[model samples]
Structures are given as structure tokens and as C-alpha cells.
Target: MAGIKQVRNRKLLPDLRKEGHLSKEIVLSTTEKHGVPAGSRLFSHHTLASVRKLSFYHPFSIPEDSLDIILAATYDHSYEHFADKEDLYLQPETRGCETWRRLRNTVGKPPKPKIPLGHPMKRGGITERKSPFSVKLMNSGVHSSQTNPGYSRQPAGGAIFFY
Candidate 1:
């Protein structure tokens, strides 16, 4: 984001000025007030003029009526907790999507568990069958069982096993 800002400040500003979209005095004054850093080769004296022009025409400098119109048209106020009843009522319905409905319905309920409790292992029982893919992989020698000859070792007499 900073890099983009810097490019706008340096490269884009100068280009706009060169195209006569900005004035010479604006360039000189802006550069003088907020001098380009020594390492900023792209943002020269000319870029400063464009920046000054841009600052004068900033969105915040827009009239209150225009700003209000823009805000009313683009800003989403539906999710604001402190929004007035009128504002909430005015918002377009966004509950058609499953995710939006789920979000709206989540109030006061404990969040669902990360791991499903319905799986056989979680229910304190082992699945008797392996997945077909796992069986195929094992038969293809791509996945070997720990009890196979390549991995198996006799337990040492001194080793203590724990359940």
C-alpha cells in the first residue's frame, strides 16, 4: 500500500503535471512544503505541483451535500450495531445467501465444534474398513503399514510400554 502511495506521489503526480492537469506554482509550493526525500528520484519538483493540485481538490473538500449523497449511495450501514432503526429498515435485504442467513442466525448459540463429533473415532469406535484410496495406495506399495518388515522392530526387554 505504501509502495502504491509512493508511486502515486512520485510517478503519477509528475505525469499529470506534464500533461497540464496541474499548475507550476502548485508543484513548486507542494514540493517546497513537503519536499521529496533524497531517495525519491521519481517524485521531483514537478510531482509536488500535482500533489498540491490534488490536495486542493481532495474528496474531503467536497460540499456536504455531495458527500452525503456519495455516502448514502455507497456506504453499507446494515452491519453497524449502533445504526438507527430507520437506517436498518432502509438497508436492502441481504439475507438471501445461505452464509448471510447463517450469520444472522448465529446469535446466542455456541459456535459449532471444529472437529465433527459424529465421526466413528470421536464416537469411541474404530471404522472397520479403510477408504478405497488408502487400500489401493497400500497395495501399490506407495504407503506401507508400520507393522510391515521395513518398519517393524521387536520391543526391547528394558522398554516400558504405556497405554
Candidate 2:
């Protein structure tokens, strides 16, 4: 295995700023394979004014994050779900194919797990009055949001970001 190249915000911040993203850290380094994973590279395009991150969506990794990252972790994970673009990067490059598209068609995105509260409706609280209602009364159950374990227990508030 190659040695890790520690990241410095002094350098990373500039790149982020060029891409319209900003960070205030004076230093940044990633020891984990995921953070600065191998095989990643700097990609440039004519349209980009400055550096913009362009990384391949490798096999989807479940990063331990206190909150969702790039709105991805928020995906309903009650069941295994792959991103829409995953198959595109496959060795065969099977983009725009039905095989990948219909993989989960039969089993749609199911609702997240939840505990049905008691009520004639299975929903907590009384409907109209003390009269109970059954699960029939409630079309949905109480649902809660979830986040994976934190990759690191860093204080979110202290971080500085430029708009």
C-alpha cells in the first residue's frame, strides 16, 4: 500500500473555492481510504472556471456520517438501493439499458421502518374523540429520520463555509 498524502486545507480550500465551494479549515488531511481514496484524480473541463471535483461513483459505500453527505445518505435505505448512475460505470458500460433500470422496479422504494402507535387507527392520539380507531384509520405510521454512524465526531458548528 502507498503512503497517505495528508491534505492541507490551505491547498484544499483553494480548490474548493475555485469550484464555488468554501471551507475555512487551515489544514485538512484524510487518512481513510474513502476520504482520499486511491484512483481518484483531478479532472478538468472547458466549462469549469476553476477546479471542480469529478470522482467516479465507485461501488456505493456506506460512509459513517452523522448526517447525510451530498444528500445521498438520505436515500431510503430500508432496502438495498443503488444509485441510478452506478451501472453506467460498469466494465461493460451498460448505460441506457433496461437491465439496470428494471432491477428494482418490482420492489419499489419501500417506506422506512416505523413502530405503529396504538389507536383504533394504529396511529397515536384520539380521532375526533376518545373513540378508538384501527390501523384502517391511519394510512401511515410515525416515521423517523436516520443517519449512519459518524465517520468522525467533529463539531459541525465550528466548521466555516463560504457561501
Candidate 3:
């Protein structure tokens, strides 16, 4: 049946006793997943003038019944608040294009094959340059245009034609 103030005061006494003497100001704040409880109160008799005379209170001094209520309310509040925030961040609009772009950039793409200027391969000379595609096509019975005119559908064997 102790009042909130009396309970907090009681909690503070033990901590002060343990320390033997107050030496500094100690701030206490709790962040639970659900949120802070309304019934939970912080009471400190020490003033700023008593900066060297302040001590922290023990959390265990609060009655079990009050602690249970505080924890339940705090857990509920934290869960709701954080869940909403998570939902907001996870929404399609918030994490669609930009996130995808970031991931794509991080993974990177294969580099493009570099074609040198003045190289015979650039001028469609199939005799000197034989690429893997051409070899495969030749192995597959598709004749190169250089070797057979009628069978050549497009530029054969990875040869580039620059007019």
C-alpha cells in the first residue's frame, strides 16, 4: 500500500547504503521493446547542488506486483511502436527501387569485352581471328562465310564489321 513516491524512495535508500556515500549523479533510463510504463516513476531527492551527493537506486526494491505491471505495459508499448516502424520501413515504396539499385551496384556486373581499335578482328577478317562462338558454330556444322557464302546467316565467328 506504499505510494509511488514512497516506493521509489525506498528503492533509493539501499543503493545509497551500498555505496556508503553518494559521489556522483547517476541517470537511469530504460528502453524496452514495447515502451516505457506509465506507472513506473523515478524519484530523486538529490538536487543539482548536491551533484557529488547523488547515488543510483536499486531496481529490485520496487514491489513484484508493480514491476510486473510496468514490464507488461512497457513490453506492449515497445512491441507496437517498433512493429509500426518496421512496417513503415519495409513498405514497397520505402525500399523498392533504391534498395534494388544499391544491391545491384554492390554485386556489380561482368565487365564488357574490350575491342581494340585497328585490330583485324574489328574489320571482319575471319581468317586471322577465330573466336569461341565461331569455333562452336563450325563444330556444330555451321560453315563460316569466309569458307561458305550460302551458309553464313550473319557475321560469323564473333567478327565485327565496321563500315
Quote the positional error of residue 36 for candidate 2 in Å: 29
Question: All candidates: CA RMSD in angstroms?
Answer: 17.3, 29.8, 23.6
Q: After superposition, how far is residue 138 of candidate 1 from its true place, in Å?
A: 43
Q: Model 3, residue 26: what's the lDDT?
A: 58
Best model number under TM-score: 1
lDDT of 2 by residue, 1-163 (tens): 1232223332222322211332332323443324454433222111222322233212224335644333432234456466565422342113323221221112223354454674334457655654354323435445521222343333677543433
Name the runs in model 1 displaced over 4 angstroms: 1-12, 15-74, 83-163
The collision pairs in model 3 are 33-78, 34-75, 34-77, 34-78, 34-79, 35-78
Native-structure RMSD, model 2: 29.8
Instruction: Report clash pairs, candidate 2.
Output: 7-28, 9-28, 120-133, 120-134, 121-133, 121-134
lDDT of 3 by residue, 1-163 (tens): 1221112222322323322344444554432323455433333223333432334422223326744434433234445654553343242313433211111112223454566764536444455665667453434654434434334334466554443
> What TM-score does structure 2 among the candidates reach?
0.13
Error in Å for residue 91 of model 2: 3.2
Cα miss at 33, model 1 (Å)? 17
Clash statistics: count for each candidate: 2, 6, 6
